[model samples]
Target: MALVTGGSVAGPGAVEAARWWMRMMRDPLATYGALGRRYGDTVRVPFGVGRALYVLSRPEHAEHVLVANQDNYVKAFTYRPLRAVIGEGLLTSEGDTWRRHRRVVGPVFAQRHVVGFAPQIVETAVAAVERWPDGVMLDAAGELRRLTLDVVGRALFGSELAGEAGRTGRSLETLQRGAVIGTFLPGATAKRGLYQRVPGLGGAIGQLDGLVQRVIRGSSGGELLNLLREGGEFSDAELRDEVLTLLLAGHETTAASLAWTFVLLSRYPAARERLEGEVDEVLGGRDPRADDVDRLPWTRAVLSEAMRIYPPAWTIERDAVDGDDIAGVRVPAGSTIAVPPYLLHRNTDIWPNPEGFQPERFMGEQQRHRYAYLPFGGGRRICVGAGFAMLEAILVLATVSRTHRLDLAPGVPVRGRAEITLRPAGPVPMRVSRR
Candidate 1:
């Protein structure tokens, strides 16, 4: 390991670069972890065509890139494959389009308005848990996906999406895998049309399209769909893209968070017991409301800790449009900056016992850096569904934790799949037992 200071950047040597690229393509998380350990937080790797990628994991680095100097950057070209699938939706769109979509779509996910969806979120979770037979092994990841899909369907779109969860989940897996593979290919940007020509990629896009159409046609006229339709800001094709983007983004991240929470709790019985105690004391056998989120600090802490360990939106990237400096690292124009939460959250310098699961970090009024924990990213382009996500996670965790506990099935060692989102690699089989 070496110390990086002053204006000079640090990274792998030319001879080591080939090995680094191979490791990155094979397993990005492990590669990034290796880079952090071997070269410190800010490693400047040579990218294609005389470009450099600076992997930044510090909190101040995140603030510098995502907040203060955001105007000098754009969503990196790495997101091109994603833009291919979802079109110019909120997640991949930029400039005037992003601004306009944010303005139109932001109101629906506002804190005050999202609270109104609490009843639906709770009811959906309760219904799903009630159907689980005791002592039977269930896929926690799949169940969470189903539960979240239902919540977004009923609460946001007034549609029943639980039926399509299985197909939708598979479709997302294919698309995400393809997107990641696409990033490493030469001339990946501006090749959206070529993506569909790939064997399985086209079907993945089609599956998502079918789901969006079902939502639009079967929607009992939810506020979001209505706004997208009546606002006249988006054309018909653009309307479908926006709806599909919300459907995928709205449910996927929250589902991943809850699934990871369940997995973490299973591994740490004490944390599980403490969480159950906190939920029991706070809710008192009643359904959780929006206000109850604040009262249940431990439950929220458990989730925060889970996110710290495995943030769903684990990586954030930006391309420098102009020369800039991040934490004294010289960044030139056209450079790519990767602010990975996985690395930042696990940085030993910032977090004591970095690998340990300690929910208490979020329980007290302990002071920390502002950009230290960015599960939802930073700046104006932060996740709009953030408020909705936390509320839904707390309520669902409370609702399910009240009556049952999910323990990992014996001999099943869950591995994380770092695709578009950081989630369990395969089905997370867990036994459901009565509390």
Candidate 2:
């Protein structure tokens, strides 16, 4: 019989080990790195008497786990906590609901649709840039987060959300930690209750719910809410789930990705110079339009390289459907399978000088393996907004690069906190000056 591991056991790979649980509670990136270094890529950490985890980082392993034989796995137990908070949203839902959500929401993120949203994106970036005072140090991460949240707000729901950015930002922080906490507890019901009891999270979910309801009610023009409301075969609960998913998923990640890109550019002057040249040539003197993105190759490449190094959607995990061997270890059914993009992107076998910042890695006809560089993930469940995110990030980066140069104040240590998505630990302090 295939083993189904879901409990505490202090054996060869005990997930209950203090170090393992500490890593789970605190720093997963370091923990994963230590595990990979110590036991190789395919280390299994036992959870209780039955459940265990398999952390794999190689390209072939990622391919086999996330794409090639993906049918053998389902979204891992880690996502379960996130689902509890969002509830059947596009990112967390599975089965027929996921298919239907994908079908209806997919078109809105098409290249044409995404490109058409560029002007709005530029307008939002410009507006945020306008508020920045020279010599004034601000949280660059927070600012970009606000800007992208506003863009997602206006583009998807045709509503303005800049005012709620601060409150919403804080709320999301609480909700993310709660997601990890819920993963240890049993069932979605436990998570839903925990979210209510948590202070910042409870307020945040309430506000997000309020905001979504307003958007759904107030969307007289946008395609997202309309498609969600009138789309056939979508239940009301599923619609809310998807709306919440898109609202959070659509913006938070792109915002964080841009934040990391700008931070990297500030630290790397040569890279910034190249980015500026590309943007200047493409845009000339006018604001960019949907027709203009294709010509901005270097700008796009810079964004690509940025995501490769610090992918906002940094980790992808799955659980085996049936007990099976991957790489070498025989993973029991119900075991969590982790193939972190953060770790995978840094795999030296696939990326030369993996930790170095080099936009040129994507410049020419470099033959890259299909699953080697999966910033947007792979397989049927790959991020539906991948196209939209790329377009948005590139356009925003170009427009901002054309107008302003932001640098983190010296000695300001920027740290990333892992959440439902990876984000700056707190504020990313930077000085914004006109380019």
Score every model by TM-score.
0.97, 0.93
Candidate 1 residue 115 Cα shift, in angstroms, is 0.5
Model 2 CA deviation exceeding 4 Å by range: 1-12, 327-329
lDDT of every predicted structure (CA atoms): 0.89, 0.79
- Put down candidate 1 lDDT per residue, 12-56, tens digits, no spaces: 655467678888877787888899998888888885667878899
Tell me the lDDT of model 1 at 282.
89
Model 1 stretches with alpha carbons more than 4 Å out = 1-7, 188-190
**What is candidate 2's lDDT per residue for 1-435, written digit by digit as tens?**
222232321123442455667776787766776766665655667666666677777777788887778889888888887787789877887888778778888898887677778778889888888898977888888888899888888888888888878887887888888877777776646666677777777887898888778777776657687777776667777777787888889888998888889888888899999878877887897777767778888888878888888878878989898876665556677778888888888877788898788888888797877777888888888999998888788878877788889988899888888767887789988988887
Q: What local lDDT does model 2 show for residue 110?
A: 81
TM-score leader: 1
